[model samples]
Target: MPYVEVSLPVRAERSEIYPILKEMEKYPEFMADLVSVEVVERKENSTITKWVSNVDGRIIKWTEVDLFDDANMHISYKQIDGDLKKFEGEWILTPVADGTEIKLTVDFEFGIPMIAGLLNPILKKKVRDNSLNMLTAIKERMENRA
Candidate 1:
């Protein structure tokens, strides 16, 4: 499995940003690589979302369960069914002096043992870039709102 983590500081409260993050469906509006995100199921504290994203021109689709911890301003997600063998991560929001620091993490495996050594590096970079793009998009969206 390869792990990627990216963080951005937003000049906004966690309360304000949490709602935006919780609304995963809106991500496509701000993130270019994201084609669509649909909420398949919603519960009091969690949601099952289907996602379609373009990763370097290749389309990847997956459905995952997102667990929200409102009190801590955190979200954890794991893939139930997807193109990858394993995909899971968490988003953490921590208070800073000026505002909030948002961190996004991605842990995944392509599930191809034979070519893992050859593709992992390229895949890791793409994932890292995508993660950064997501954080940047959120930061821009929040800051611009202020």
Candidate 2:
């Protein structure tokens, strides 16, 4: 598995930030590489979203069920089906002084036979870059929000 984690301090209150974070369906609009995201199903505290992302100009898609914990300011997700063998992660939010500390963690594996190890390094970098890009996009949007 390839893991990528990022922690960023955003100058937005946790209450203000959590709402934007809950709106996962809007990711494709702001996150550059996210081409499309649709909420297929939603329950009381969980949602199933299907996403298509362009990575290195190649289209990769996946479906994940996000479990939202409103009280704790956390979002955890695991792949139900995708272009990969295994994908799971979480987004954790903690209150800071006049802001929120957001952390994103992702674990992914291509699940391809034989060449998996060979592609690990490349995939690791991609995951790290993508995570950073996502965080930057969110920070920009949140800070600029009216």
Candidate 3:
């Protein structure tokens, strides 16, 4: 298994960030390489989303269940259906000064065990880039909102 975690400060409130985070389907518009996302099912504070992301010219698709925790300002997700064998993560938001500290943690494992070890290094870079890209998109959108 490979894990990646990143924490960044966003000049946004928990209230503002939480809603945007729940609407994961909108990320493809702002995030690089994210081509499309569809909401398969949604219930109180939880949703099943189908995503298609372009990486290295290949489109990777996955479906994940997002669990939102308003009180804690956090959202966690696990891949319920996807091309990958295993994928899970969480987004944590902590109120700071006049903004919020957002942290994203991702745990993933490739389907092919033999190649997983060999691809770990490159996979780590992609995960980190994706995480940072996500935060950057969030910050850009929330800050520029009218």
Candidate 4:
């Protein structure tokens, strides 16, 4: 398994950031890697979403279930089925002196044991960079939105 965690401090309140995070469909508007997101199903506290993303010219697709905890400013998601063997993580938002600190954690497994050692490191770095880009995009959007 490969895990990647990225955090960013944003000059925005949790109330403002949480809504944007929940609106996964808008991701492609800011996050270039994301091609499309469709909400397959929705509930008061959870949603099933299908996503298509471009990674280094490869098209990766997945369907995930997201659980949102509004009171705690937390969101967790796990892939029901995807290109990767495992894809699950959480987004945590906490208040800080300046604004809010947002963190993202992703745990994934490519399901190839024979070349695991050779591929894991490269995959981990790609995922980490993608995650950081997402956080940076959100930060810029939040800070500049007025």
lDDT of each: 0.95, 0.90, 0.88, 0.95
Per-residue lDDT over 1-146 for candidate 1, one digit per residue giving the tens place of the 0 to 100 score: 79999898999999999999999999999999999999999999999999999998899999999999988989999999999999999999999999999999999999999999899899999999999999999999988874
Candidate 2, 88-129: lDDT as tens digits: 999988888868888999998889869988998898899889
**Least well predicted 10-residue stretch by lDDT in candidate 3:** 20-29
Give the clashing residue pairs of candidate 2, or none. Answer: none
Question: After TM-score superposition, what is the CA distance of residue 59 in candidate 4 from its true location, in Å?
Answer: 1.0
**3-96 per-residue lDDT for model 3 (tens digits):** 9999888899988898888888888878888999999999998999999998878788899999988788789999998888888999988899
Clash number for candidate 2: 0
TM-scores of the models, in the given order? 0.98, 0.95, 0.94, 0.98
Q: Give, for candidate 1, the lowest lDDT window spanning 10 residues.
A: 137-146
lDDT of 3 at 53: 91
**Candidate 3 vs. true structure, TM-score:** 0.94
